[model samples]
Target: MHKVIIKYVLIGVLAATALTSPVRAEAVVPLTVQQFFEVCQPTRVTDFVDDNDYIQFGLCMGVIVGLSSLMDLNCQLDRNDTPNHLKADLSGGNTSLTAYRQTMWNYSNDNPSLRSFPVGMLAASLAEEWPCIEPL
Candidate 1:
């Protein structure tokens, strides 16, 4: 009975700490540009391609889209430059995630470079084509 009480107390403490942990809205490290490249190596990409690892590919795409959304929230994306169609699609439904994933894969494949990070590159491509007249 004592052990059971201690276990419940410990769980409650952990839950409280987790809930109260400081989570900044913006990260100190720029994930899209640097972390993406570090994590998504050419070899990994190749492995996914060769294996047709849809699961892994989907996970990576999800992360990229998430990062892109964060960038958008941080006023990094050019909303003004984004086409109405793209914006509409992105805001419309879950299908937009697929669209972004396709774009990321094609962009990453065509523009392979040591300096290029797939997520950052994709974000830049979108910005360049549909740059906001001013930062949001």
Candidate 2:
């Protein structure tokens, strides 16, 4: 009696869930590696800052570096410098995160294939833009 009722209720619940699950399954569109990069790439300078004008480039760089690092994409930084460390070095009275973001954005446009690991491209760009000068 009671057992029979509970068994039917469970079956009904299972059937209902099975019918609804396909809707969620269909909503998730799978993205390829290139597509993922295209979607994640920075579009504008404001993407790296807020109303306060404080640097948010670290966060954007973190997501780019973090995902690539986890994927083992070989996006190593020069001397293994972290994003915050790099941003700190780049920061100055005139230079801003916006400039850094724009530089990265331009690099991304010129070389779309490197999107999987942009930090490598960024390191190269930084090296070009500001070569080290040793004092004699």
Candidate 3:
């Protein structure tokens, strides 16, 4: 009975550790400049024209840009720079829109003056005018 109990306890401990272990998964689609523009354009415009949506949209875009930049740097996806482990902390981390938004909120908090209205308008304009020459 003692040996059986010990085996069960060991099994439980191992199972718990396995469950808690972090897993890293590759990004589903590499974020392209074209996709970035496509996602940002409408959101920016809607925020600009509508006072109600401006703040939310602006903050959202800021976060998206921020995350993309970070991912690009970490993954060495940028054309100019060599890839590095700048995002070592985020290793085995989950990637999703909610995570991006949270990161944006943190960024906004650090820079309080970066309000939604202006940022949103600017992002909208950039998205609208900029042509993504890069092939996805």
Cα lDDT of model 1 overall?
Answer: 0.48
Task: Please tell me which predicted candidate would have the highest TM-score against the true structure.
Answer: 1
Span of 10 residues, lowest total lDDT, candidate 3: 23-32
Candidate 2 error regions (>4 Å): 1-58, 61-93
Q: Clashes in each model (backbone N, CA, C under 3 Å)? A: 3, 0, 0
lDDT against the true structure, each candidate: 0.48, 0.44, 0.41
Off by over 4 Å in 3: 1-70, 78-92, 113-136
Q: What would the per-residue lDDT of candidate 1 be over residues 27-95, giving only the tens digit for each residue?
A: 223245444443343334445543234444544666757745754443434466545323212432354
Question: Which lDDT value does model 1 have at 106?
Answer: 52
**lDDT per residue, candidate 3, 59-86, as tens digits?**
4456466654554444433343532322
Ranked by TM-score from best down, the candidates are 1, 2, 3
Per-residue lDDT for 1-136 in model 2, tens only? 9999999999999988966765433332113333323433555655534422222333455544543333222223233443432322232236544455455556566777776653444544443443332223
Give residue 48's lDDT in candidate 3 (0 to 100): 59
Candidate number that wins on TM-score, 1 or 3: 1
